[model samples]
Target chain A: MRKILLASLLIPALALGGAGCSGKKDAGESGTQLGGTVHIDGSSTVFPITEAVGEEFQMLHRGVRVTVGISGTGGGFKKFCSGETDINDASRPIKEKEALLAAEHGIGFIEIPVAFDGISVVVNPANDWVDHLTVAELHQIWMPDSPVKTWRDVRPAWPDREIKLYGPDVDSGTFDYFTETINGESQVSRPDYTASADDNVLVTGVAGDRDALGYFGYAYYAENTDRLKVVPIDGGGGPVTASHTTINNGTYAPLSRPLFLYVSTKGGERPEVREFVKFYLQNAATLAAEVGYVGLPARAYELGWQRFESGKTGSIFNTDKARSGLSIVELLSL
Target chain B: MTAGEWRGVPNLARRHWQSLWLRRLFQALTWLGVMLLAILLFRIARQGAVWLDWDFLTSFPSRFPARAGIKSALAGTLWLIGLTALISVPVGVAAAVYLEEFSRAGRLKTFIEVNIANLAGVPSIVYGILGLAIFVRGIGLGRSVLAGALTMSLLILPVIIIAAREAIKAVPQSLRQGAMALGATRWLTVRHHVLPGALPGIMTGVILALSRAIGETAPLIMIGALSYVAFVPEGPMDGFTALPIQIFNWTARPQQEFHGLAAGGIIVLLAVLLLMNAAAVAVRHRFQRRR
Candidate 1:
């Protein structure tokens, strides 16, 4: 009976306490008190930058809730195209099919390039023979039914050890980018190689095996430089290793891809969403760099802000091949 | 001579040797399981000890690993589990009592029983999809804590109901008869006699179901739980992130420091689970002593 009496008293006291706190918050903020939710879902690759931006945005606008989900690039687009999410973070440009779906749903989106991510090719530290690999060599190794089995098969001066390959799984955007660039088609690869969605597993595999060759995101390679040797890629001009400068400057040819944000026109019209997008573009350079991704040039962000403010909706790159030789700034300007 | 010697051996001696070998094999298998768990715990502790601190428990997740913490995720998990328990327990226990004590045994009962058993076997991701469609979209909860809790309730309802039915069934039939003989109504008998007897078992089942819900990442992910929530949820309508999702996000990062942070998150999760189970055990013991 005493417990019941105490509980009855405590409930009202808790209610009063909660009411008091909320009243204080309402009274404390007087001007420009923006309150709403900004929902974002998309690529795990761009998740870090978006998450960082969301965190800082929330700190500034306490009433606006920013929620970010990692549903992979395609899955995020599924939600984005359906108008379920305000913004979608994409590691690659929206596919033709996804664009058609969005158009069908009457969901117009503004494409804003946020960061640069380079697909890095890495090998075991023990392998001393490989100095660089040409685009053709990569295609020869990863292409379906390729005859290259041993390192000696590629070059007679190299050892006769059987080459063991590792790479990202088929579902990943990284796999899509790598296969399209290297094999000239998406999802085309040799079936016998070890594949995992987790880059750390690939890192561990190459670190343990002397004959292993693997490729994953540049961040993974940057994290495990001691255990893995990064192999420079020769697109056409010359071999260039992946670095922040190389990726940002487009020297990392045929590999450095721009990450993007697709914001719905309907969502963009909302004051909270508009403010959040502006903040994201303004701070994405520093946040992207902090998260180990290459930030886009200042002029690129300027172009993005202009495009977003003007409400220009739809993708700029008309074809997948259009992205190969052109930089993000050039594409944005177009 | 060899055939005669084999026939002459005592049958008991051969049976004894076989039994001894079987016992030894079972003992070895048990040891292997325990050793594996011990090794895993040891490795996690070794990696996470340096990272676990007061700040880790107080601060929100950050891009910088040193400043990142599980405060928001921890609060979200507590809210989810608490709300899930509140929603699932009474409904589950009542359903169990109805099926075990009140409902007539017929084709309907048999079908319901079979479906519940099958639902228990269904992969959790299937429930996640259902939750995504029904609660998140159809009900328009918009990825709030209430939506997540409701989805979790659905996911764990089958396990709770089955466990609760067993607990209710374990109550002695004579107790009901004795209460009825004393002029008690059916509802009164159940409330006074059967439910008290089943309380400890029900509590145990509820705690176990809740523990499973706490660690689940797939269903929550399907329901659109955010992986990056910096602030603690202030109400049921607020967006939230849980401990498992935070750990998953951390482990997926390319940085080595984040991996250590994941280990720390696991330690925190396990501690929470242990505390819950201990409370369940204590409650069960008190109820049993009363009986």
Candidate 2:
């Protein structure tokens, strides 16, 4: 009551009246007893899993609330290392320098593999006869320096079509991976492709236009299978379509990567954060697959639970609070 | 009246010489300001020069940030600015001309004037969402460069219209009075006497609007400009990228090399902006001095 009165009194003084409060009311209403807010942001690719897991986690653990924001992978990491979020949903692993930034900020986090995703190559269903494409053809289509202007330019025997393209924006991890795998560099792509941070937009673009091709997360393609066709990416020899089986068996090429959620060890000691992470690992598998992401083996969640349990005992955690001025170059070189 | 009185001002010259102290003080302050401005521009130019070069402008981003060129971004910015100018200049000038020369002082005109004034302060990012809704999604333009240009035109329109009005207002009333007296219609008087006088000021406003549009990151991002474009765009509708997007992309990367690249991207952008400003100032001054 006093807090509410104080807030009312202080309202006019707030040039920053629109607060960017990260606390979730349903999760953490108290400044004590696991009742503080847990803010999670990053990776539209990992957003579905994070959102699904966060919703269920909050439902199960009534006292702990979680909110997830999808700002792409690199964008999420920037906020994560800035200490804006307690957990970050990342499509790719923390790069050498990102790890150092977290260390510099005294933020030690536990990296847990939540699920797996296979980046899917989608084409308009109107075109037939084309089933597989080599990495060289992908280079022809996506490489920054490629001179190929049309589908026939890619392969002269194919019908001459003005190849329309769509893909993720540069800040996306999937874009980085596609560029690395296809163009032999990260963040390098043919500028001609229609780009968006949202995968749904890419799906719509590919589905609406004939002679168009796009790449996005497999789940989007799966959901829109009736409207769009999945082109098999040639993995050296045979064509490979991203499936639960193929992706799990490691046949989806370099684009198949593990999705992650990093829980802050320091923050996890708090009841709400601890309860939320515990609830997350406890039900993540079934709920993850329900949200169209591949679930990991049962043993993984069990180990994570054990770690979370050990964390309360002050044994399983190495708090970054003690490491002031930790060498960034040293940590990154590791 | 005949203007021959200034030639007989021998005694008036001595009186004017008494104004020398004020002129000397003004010159001193002016020199001080000029020095300060030069220093500021020098600092900005030097910092930006670290990243501007032929190779730097032409290369695509690599793992090593130093190797990345802003060719696609430069190309995209040019297309966006050129298209934005094409849409805005004629439209904004026409609106200004109508408002100044045609629209009588009335309720509707006052409403429009107030609204245009209010629009000048409307946050740029609002235009982004508007573009997203109207151009990208609603009209199904779908993140095309045309959509971005249309959004930018809306952003800079207020400033152009306002500047154009001021430019037309600054024209001597005698010029219009003379043109009308010579048997010209109102339209003819404005076209023959006013527009020629206002062109330099309109160009100045245009160059300034283009400057604001080129540096704006929010609306463009909202309308879906690419950050890592690989190829140069050839048409208005082609998927495009720009300099600010490239700078943002590089700044967000974890690599140290990218930080340098971000700084470099900033330099290239500033140089283009400076060039545009310098050209506009020269044109405006040239025209003013000629008249």
List of chain A TM-scores, every candidate: 0.91, 0.77
Give the Å shift of residue A35 in candidate 2: 3.1
Interface RMSD score of each model: 5.4, 20.5
Cα lDDT tens digits, model 1, B218-256, are 999888898988777766777899999999999889999
lDDT by residue for model 2 over B1-291, one digit each (tens)? 223467765556556666887799899999999999788667656555666778997775443445668887887887787778778888999999999999999999999999999999999999998997898778877556789999999999999999999999999999999998889999998887899899888888888889999999988876656544445554555567788877776554423355567777777788789987887788778777887
- TM-score to true structure, per model: 0.94, 0.48
Clashing pairs in 1: none
Q: For residues A1-334, what per-residue lDDT tens digits would candidate 2 score against the true structure?
A: 2244245334522422322233344235555534545667667567656655665554455444454544566756766775667777787766667777877888777766667678888888987846777777888888876787778888878778788899988878888778876886778888878998767678878989888889987777766788888888885757888887777655666556667777666777777677777777877777767656776556666665665566422211122421232221222222
* Candidate 1 local Cα displacement, residue B273, angstroms: 0.5
Compared with the true structure, all predictions reach lDDT values of 0.90, 0.72
Question: Quality of candidate 2's docking, in CAPRI categories?
Answer: incorrect
List, in the given order, the native-contact fraction of each candidate.
0.52, 0.00
